[model samples]
Target: MLEVIGLSSAAQTLYAALVERSPATLAELGHDTATAARLEELGLVTRLPGDPPRYVAVSPELALDVLIQARTQQLTEARHRIAQLAARFHRSAPEQDSANLVEVVMGRQAVSRRFERLQREARRQVRVFDAPPYATGAAGNAVEFELLARGVEYRVLYDRRAVEAPGTLATIIGYLGAGEQARVGEVPVKLVLSDHPMAILPLRHDEHAVESALVVHDSTLLGALSELFEMYWERAAPLHVRRGRLAEATGAAEARRDLLPLLAAGLSDTAIAAHLGWSDRTVRRHVRAMMTRLDAQTRFQAGYQVVMRGWLAEP
Candidate 1:
């Protein structure tokens, strides 16, 4: 909460303590005049108007507003200054400087920070190739939805396993419902690109810690990455998240329903099994059952039945 309000660690510690143990004098709290004075100035701690005045914590609603406004104003001013400096810097930047085109960022925190910053600063679009192993959580998903709400087009390409993991299909369904375009297929690398100019990719494909990341600016490499994204997007099958009974259902029925589009798109059963996180035998079994249900003799007939039955349409 203090982080959200932009308070220093020391201030947060003192404020939390006061809120927990209020109506106590500074001395009783084992604090001297200096610390108390600072907290008072920040409107985190208040004093009762009586003999030997006691310090108390201000209401969180009022104090948080004060802190948030202060930080917001400071951010507004800083952004103004940064805009001016950026204009000057970009004006002097060398367009042909190959040495400065790519920057390496080290450590997990720094990589995560840069990734989130790129998403937050995206102007028109954000393209992401999501794969495992991933340490990020629902917060990242929430932020993406928020950005989508603000008219930033999100094109997300997820690895087959990433979508097949338990509980992920529903999340993808929600994303599709919110106007996000998604595809599921095998991808070589995890990537994040904002508006086609800036990109963040792992330093090594197999490393799990995100120990290093490469930030790519506008360059030939960026173009290659963009083309690579387009290539996968083209070959990838469209993802339609089913709702109602399909949404409430899981297991074989759910997986079979998801498999229809790939079948319609002419993907082999092996590829469909890989995407659906099932074995070849399981896929074949489901396909045979589906063919029987439709009284069809071939996969093509079953796929035609899918379209005719409206199984591929949005709910």
Candidate 2:
């Protein structure tokens, strides 16, 4: 390590010693030189034949200038190596931000930040094809609210099969009531995106799958998506269709119908909470209430009774 910074010192000592003695043994060449080992380690001297001892430095005084040249070469090689390492890392950069195109962002936070920036810049409208099953949760909703509050025109398309949670439905209606246009329909894929500046996340079913996000801000691309969303919106149902269900059923009943089977399959409350976007306490309460409703002493018994009653078999 010290060899790199001490190269100049090492070169000077080796050359000075050689200038004094044309040919000398290793001991005589750098008898008491601090950098003797460093010079020999650098191949600046050679051992020669002699009974007592003999060593010859590679070059004499005038040509000993090669030491400085060698030093320059070493510095150049070091800089080139560092530059190559920097270039390699540059190529591995996650998102490529360019003036005229969408940026590809990797990892969760970067993707979310790009989406937030788009929402902040939006003016005329914001159109969405929401794939709730792949939703990024609270952080995403906060950004949605931010855009809606700015009076940006907002449109969302939701998958019909999404198991809507309590406040989630209310939130949607509230957004729609505030002039945001929302629609629900079935889609073959799971994703959430908007026009112009849009973010997308692929559906992931594996436990170890990485979450990826992308944001596109190009105007032409945004316009094309806006048109596609408008066409889909024409055939989509409004949030009002499902708002009634939340009012008619208790939260426990909703949980019983939706989460009982998953719970019985040995999923923990946290996993259920993450999947359904419900609080752990809420999930636990629902489980306890279901146990009482079935007159069962435990969750296992309640699950057994639920299946026995054919509720599990119902659509």
Leading candidate by lDDT = 1
Per-residue lDDT tens digits for candidate 2, residues 98-166, read 553554566655655655666666665665666544335543366666677776777777654442433
Q: lDDT score, residue 17, model 1?
A: 77
Instruction: Estimate the TM-score for candidate 2.
Output: 0.40
Where does model 2 exceed 4 Å of error?
1-100, 138-140, 163-167, 188-210, 219-223, 241-246, 249-315
Off by over 4 Å in 1: 1-96, 138-140, 244-246, 249-257, 262-285, 290-315
- Residue range with the least summed lDDT across 10 consecutive positions in model 2: 240-249
Local accuracy of candidate 1 as per-residue lDDT tens digits, 152-178:
999988887676555666677678778
TM-score of each: 0.55, 0.40
Could you tell me which 10 consecutive residues in candidate 1 have the lowest summed lDDT? Answer: 241-250
lDDT of 1 at 33: 70
Clashes found in each candidate (C-alpha, N, C closer than 3 A): 0, 3
Q: Relative to the true structure, how large is the alpha-carbon lDDT of every model?
A: 0.76, 0.57
State in Å the error of residue 298, model 2: 39
